[model samples]
Target: MKRITTLAGTLAFALTVGFTPVTLIQAQNKGRTEISVKELPKISSNSILGSFNADFSGHNVSSDFLINHLGEWLGTGSDHTYKLLKQNKDELGIKHSVYDHYYKGVKVMDDMILLHEKNGKLTYVNGEIITDINLSPNQQPTSQRIRSIIISDLKPQGKLTISNIEEVITKVSNGRKAVLYHASKVEALSMKPLKAFTYYIDNASGTVVKKNSRMHDADTPSTSTTYYKGDQSITVDSYNGEFRLKDNARNIHTMNGTNLDVDTINGGIINVEEYISPVANYTAVDTKPAVEVHWGMKNAYDYYMTRHNRNSYDGNGAKIDNYYNFDFGGFTGGANAAALDTPLYGGIVCMLYGNGTLFGGLLTLMNPVVGIDVAGHEYSHLIIGRNGLGGLNYESESGAINESIADMLGTAIEFYSGSSPNWTIGEGIPTASFLNPSPSPYMRSMSDPNNVNPGPQPDTYNGTYWASTANPDADNDHGGVHTNSGVGNYWFYLLSQGGSGTNDIGNPFNVTGITIEKAEKIIYRALTNYMTPNTTYMDAYNFTKQAVTDLYGASGNEQQQNVKAWYAVGIGNGILATSEAVRNQDHFNIYPNPVKEGVLTIENDKNNVSVEMYDASGRLIKGAQKLNKGTNKIYINNVQKGIYLLKVTSEGSGISTKKIIVE
Candidate 1:
């Protein structure tokens, strides 16, 4: 699975705004003045923001105009000001402008909105905004009692170090409620510094409002190989007519890592030997594994830059320094790779690839250097860390999501860097590890996560082999960050490559694959734009559905597939795209959308259905019709020109609903 035309020129939230279920709120008719069907704004909405498809044939407005008229649009108070955060333009020429909510000159952390534009017209506005912040930051300091109580509670065994403490307001209940809290990070000094947490102490009640993980670690199994990838080319620094395993172009350094303390290797500067050769040809036996890591990192970098347009993992071309032959003792075994902060040694953040003990030389013991996926996976963890894909600690469901995302991206990069039909993570590692020794023993399988070689993972959420989220970190692979990852890993596979099976819920399902090219973009967008820390599997459903709607369109194939794929993974019910009376499909087609003659044709594939039409203000129109199993045409007489919602209820159950222009 090694084919490089590019590295070697291979293939190339809210006021507080934590994740919550996205609720659909129908526009409640407050001021009901009927407008013509031709005059109705082409609209869309989530619980927070709305979308408008406008034609700037005559007039155009700039992003500055949107920022200036923020209050007029979202009904924010005069005390609120929107500070421009950043603007980005994709290859499709769509411009995205982000603005954060500022109340009385203070930034409300997660409360921000994103505007999508094409040419000049605003296409969509999203993200929650915080308003009516009555509590001033200068109001009061946290009481001593509360601080003492918090410190006592946190430091049970070790010294509790509280840092990065500040006051901020966060909103919940869909941004309808707000609370002020003294937010600070607390870590037990005597414990592994790896586990640090951020706490939001309620300023009023002094209760621990929330605790989130600040530790983002790529501590898991994934590997690449010089053993499998065969001979390859890598960029080496040319110095004194010698070549060193230091890629100046990509800013990557690969160290020998012969004998380093695994405990303190994560941090501190070290003067280690870089794998080098007197001449350009490095055929030394010792340099082979180092070549694997150096080559893998460059490819992973190219994969992100080439596909997603990210310059590097941090999107700022962050230098990547790595150490091969890293020794992860304590049964973690061979092939353990992690994005650890190398201390005085490199004084830079480095990804450590373990030099595993070759168990009988026929199997590699544990994690690291399993192949391109390891590099891609660890690199993805860095991206997830930067993007907050998995919040708080890298454990439980959040951690599972974090790992799953890495697996997906890793597999994608594996497919990208080379050619492979087997979408398995560590498949390229030549010698099968003992943990899951088989004909092809890879770490994780996106195509079939249930492949019980390395570990039996869940394909559907809460399905067979589902890891207990409540399990302690010391026990269950950090609450099955590696196990429960199968749900999302399988979801990505089904989303990309189409599959049919009954989920654990016993719901038989079938989804049309949107292909990896499109599917990857959807995942990328949802993870980067919509998802927040602490987003659940169900919350991911909403975010991804919105992502599908944003990238493609509502009621389209991508949306349908996205929902069904998640459903197959046991997240939400699969949605069927219904007719709009003017809805276009192969079996159904009605001429111009706003039924000109007021005659609406209904198609009932399910049980007998009832149709109800509502105006923009949620006011039901005068007419309601009952249609049979076949197609029925009904004449509309009382309906006037306005945007109406056509609710199709099948038998006694409601399938789905949307708005339409009924003339």
Candidate 2:
């Protein structure tokens, strides 16, 4: 039964993708200024020009350009070019040519300026119409560089602030030159010294770029620490140093220091007191928050890298920045305020923890699992932002699918960490008790829908169904992504747990009964390889089935089970009839469950048994022989590694049957 259902679902999904046209939705248009591709100068071998070209082609570009192009194609004044140079100016030591041309007494090339329009207007490389060109006389170089000026103001409390600001002067053959200043600085500030100053001093001119006077002393190191039985203790010289807790004999049990802390004497008991510190002032020079925030961020990063082998949110090793006390006032729902990835930080991933109200709310949700699933869930949103999964909140199936993907991956992460098989979302958040009428099973329940009040179930009697509506702006809560996701979430749970059997709803399904380990393997492959950014539930259904087939042959039960699960969740098989009458009347028949040599007994009721053998995608590969009634055997000797469907048809009877594999 599982094999039949899987074969049918796989075939239907293939048909859907083969025939459906995937539409690419356009994101918001930020701003647009057209550039004539012809106006850009071609690359040449002149040493200076070659060097400039090489710099442009190589690493001397801005991050914005790198983001768009990664140097895939070269064109001047494109976002790619602007971003690449903007990002790497310090490394490449290139000056902003536009700023240099305007502020410094530098001659501009004619190629840099172009006549626009039949209107005879002048324009720069990016088609910005220039009414006039003004070149100011070279001003006397100031003793205070921008970097130095900013860093000088920074007050280093306990740690020193080091600024590596570079100033470059580029001169052309005609003595036309420009001075470019690039700044990079790291401030080491300690929170212990109340009057300590952390400042950024530009290395080039020795001026402060930024400074803050409101500095707080770092936490005092713990003294008189004692070790209890089996609890090892180490007296570190500094509070900000790394310390690993060991057993009675000093065998390291766990590493904790500076960023991480525990409450109890032993490693098993974590101290919550260490987490209770006032939020750090964003404007303060010694702008370090209490240790807990650091620990959370570090844990989040480690979760992705260690558990899933994922470097960062985008699966690329993008650097992540931490933002403390992100204000979303009056929204107190979870622990340590919520942390999420934001795009504003130069596509540099960020996790922001709110003050007590919001931050606490987030932490409340995160406490259930110490591993990366929850962190991975939030981080996946960051990837969604970069890849363009519409607004975080919306009313469409898209939003639900988005949330489901997060939940799915989160569960995968938990499973990766060797955690138990549980299908509860936000198990740590306490607010669900107040918000949801039915508590305990805070979110969706996979195995028992009754656990959560008003859980997901098919509205068969009312004729309402899943994926029936196309409204994308529906925000039950941010479009009810959390709410509607139950459909898909439950579907996964049923698929994972129910295994090749009829679900509670009495729908035919194939439970592969494979371990979660195998399921994770199949799902990860499907998500990375088969799915698109805008993938819908149907796409997921199709993609995952194919993915399973690819990984474990077409006739494989693993693939079949995935198909049966989707069907049980009320997603109609486009090819299979929902009516029992039609299914019973159909005339397809294939015998010998464990047949060898690929020889199967075919019993076609009608004289017109037209056998069509299809490979997963519903693509008909060959026609089967018309078999006579009782016991006519057909040789499927050359059948490939997959479950094939034998569609036998008579005048008024049509039935699709499943064929299995021996090899």
Candidate 3:
């Protein structure tokens, strides 16, 4: 991996020269501005919830206390109340309570708050908070009116299930707005119930203001033996002197199934007894597949917790449920697929896996349940959906982004598990012989997407078969989500491995390897905090650069490397060219050296460059440089009266010097 020095050295250089660099000050200011979003804040008993005040004691309480006291504590009378949306204990055993805010018996849309309690003391609080509102007579529409509107909208498909009508305050970017609405949720049961869809109807206008689907589809291929923690471990819950497949440590549940005989109404097998267990207590030998699934879940949980301090996929420790031996069409459906069901219960996502077809019905492939990468990939879908900052839309480029993220996290998790062939998805899983007589070993290869035996997807954005959603093709995997995702998949590989190669569009470039650790952090932060629902490849390019900027600063080499990485992936074309001018030793010049309007313009004929300004006493004063070619402008409004030296550098050009006067 390429190692680069951090900006601490620049700070030291500034101190030796007698001036604190403006770059450092700017970072401090930026930190202050983003603190509220990046860190959890303590919540007091008097913390306001809507117009009402939170009334629970701040410390030493049980889960029951939170459940029973929320309504009274928040000063919500019978008319206005709080309902528990979800609750779970984090890895640290801290209980997190998530609630939906309601006013005068109407459900608020997307208005949720969370309280994190450690050892019975409220340690932190987050989520949407509404402060401005008029508790006036905002009468909500009647349930009959809401049901009529919702039923009409959901006609011919979804069946309305439960409905909540409430009046509540919502936050706008500028301030807050109090509104009355009925939140109606619906689900349609065909062979099985599809994900529930929710709609918020404005009581006054009787128009649908917003809509949400509570379902999240989370997938896979593979047969090879891999080791995790010497031997695979499963978390079992004790019930009535019998043990069941449940991992309370990571809040995951496992179930066994026979030919997907799920009771759609109950959401699983007719009886929980179908859940598998070893004949003897606490044994991994009997339930090998279940043990593998449990181990993968633990590794994924560890990856999120140890790497990002996230408790689980939701960042709040929500439970994850999985069912194995889930053959959809009896034994025939085995080996063809594994799936994370879209249905969500109390904010939890469930996964279903099938055994391979009996008598080699699937050719060479085996059951996908045991592949660590497959488990990670399926779990990531739920994480991406539950992401609060913004979720990638489930169609087109957004959907491709969603798939690529899952693939990336899946691969990363596999690597974390000390698995071999980390660059290949389902590396240990056996492949099929559908396309050839020989059985391949991988479902997808990150380093070489085209190498997948059965079918190869485009690795470059403009590769010959690159799928685009512009012209719809329903038969094409929902606008080629699995296919086009190779673009991102390969990009991550290049970012991790540091190679010179042609991108999907046949653009040639070299990237400095940044190791998987740094690479995952950049990708995770961008996907979680910055990338919005409809984020495209171009948007990911921009957000990833911003993520690097946040972690390594604007002027550091990390940002430069980030630009190069994206360019290697066939994006950020101009960014690298601009930086190249300075490195190529092009004629670098700065005009109007004597500051009058506090602005300085720089021009480089051949390459993009960066600049640092130092005082006459050799103290670094400013360095937030992105020296693009042709009329690069910077403001030195606070330079003060002094003689200063400006240093310019780039990848091709070694270093150049210029002097400026602050008038």
Candidate 4:
């Protein structure tokens, strides 16, 4: 499913280019390339821009050279130009520069140009450029007018304090209709450091076209005994004459939530009702559940800082803003649920907890804040939200990666804190189930991710389901991000515990188990250094494998185990890393090109060929093991008529995939 951020002022846009002059040139191997603003590729994958030797007469060039002559090179008028976004030298000694495309002094969303140079020679060029845009400025709303529109429409809760506001140009789409918009960029009101929203208001129509949440920070003092921590010294913050639950040592703050108003655009702590102060200082210790929450938040923070050397979720000394006792109606029921806004809520990263209870027939109730793994999991989500970590798109493969990584890291944090049964998330939550609640209710398990508290989780690639094709939307966990996340979760478990077992597709394999410490470091490096916003499962596998190689030798047991773990989870590309020689494309063959009755035959040089089939959507259909050498028949009689892939594997032949059709 395509997970869209739908807010009063959220934007989803694709560029629409117009006519412009350009010159096309042919490169040695690259196709004919055009140097036109409107003609440039929007994404980086297609940014080869022909060959370096063929273009520019094999001369080295700099970003400054392109900057000075870009207008003439693209034949754009004076109304548009490129502005340097940032420049940095990578770890490999390559200079990288990013530029934002501006039209008539307003920034265009996603119109970026990236230049990578090695030793003063241009090695890469990629960007989204648009030329000849007609900027007919209408008598649109001014900055104040746009701000007013946002304020009036949003009806934000609590006191409104606009942090920053600016102007920009963006393409806005109301449903299928798209238009150019002059917009006012407004930051959400800050209740704390990392709790606010960023908004883009269309000045032309006074409508919000785009927005994202700013969100994430904490202090400590010694206090009395607590229910959760059990008579231990707790941290508290004292200022002037008031005592609050903010922890100065760990930089954690606990806010009390009383009036859980939901109708407001920014679901904020209601201030008008004297609804719980910004910081809580309990009148009595027993009356405060925030105490337990404060303890859990501190544990999560320390987990990352001590284990990963991460200062905070953003790797900066930002305090954590945590709120408890959220009584928000409808969805506020704490039963088996907790929420950390994936996107910032007006720029705040706070965890909301519900006081779950036994209803007429409700099976389980939960206080999510008390669970260390749950706390760690929610906080990990904030860490992944940072600029790196592939941005782990909240849809499809990337989305599942996002969920699984969070689960794995959250599990890591729990283990770091000495929690038992480290593989289980929300293990601390008491069994609030109406029937047979003795075992205690848990959210999920890493060891057996296929079986979850709530259904729909697919533990292996073969069991995977896409939100785009299945049930899309937040209700369906954004295309089964949580469900398919089981694949990665199981991989982590296997990597942590070395064993051989039958995979979801019924393939038996053994994987070397690596310590969780090593696995975590590799995953962390991959997320921060090697990953991009649109990374896929294959990309993640490759990235993690490379990470393991970077830390350990390429041919070491660690690397092999990493590859095997990925393969065990149904990511077969790991075999390519194990041995490059076995991946020859012309080694095997399959016959009956398009099977008439869904029966396919494979002819191979070796016996014991393993086979697996998948539908057009990349979902696993069926599999077989130990096929004979010369000729083997695989029946897909029940397989529907459509395009499919048949992947054959052998111990000696590696893996070969062929596309098939059932007529």
Best by lDDT: 1
Write model 1 residue lDDT over 467-523, tens digit each, in one string. 887632545676788888899988898899999989887989898899888888888
**Residue 390 in model 2: lDDT:** 22
What are the root-mean-square deviations of the candidates from the true structure over C-alphas? 12.8, 21.2, 15.6, 13.9
Which ranges of candidate 4 are over 4 A from the true structure? 1-234, 238-244, 260-289, 335-346, 357-364, 388-390, 433-440, 462-472, 576-663
Mind giving the per-residue lDDT tens digits that candidate 2 earns over 106-212? 22211121011111111101111111222222322243453244334433233332323223221111112121222223323222211222233333444443222
Q: Against the hidden reference, what TM-scores do the models get?
A: 0.65, 0.41, 0.58, 0.58
Error of 2 at 199 (Å): 38
For model 4, state the Cα shift of residue 638 in Å: 54
Residues 1-663, candidate 4, lDDT per residue (tens digit)? 011223211211223222221221111112233233333222222111110101121123444444444554444555765666567774555565666667776776545555656456443453344443565554556656655765675465454555455667654333322345666667655332123455767666677665543321103345443334343345777665556777777788776554443224664444422113234344365434566666667777887888677887888877787666554333323443343443323444567654554332242455434555666776777787773422554544556777788888877876776634368766555554544445435667788765554544665685544234132333455466766777888888888887677776777779888888888888876676445443556666766765564455344578778888888878764553212111112334454445565677665567667888888788999956567867677887898887776667788657665566677
Question: What are the per-residue Cα lDDT tens digits for candidate 3 across 98-151?
Answer: 665555544544444555564464433433333222344445667787767756
lDDT of 3 at 176: 21
lDDT of 1: 0.59
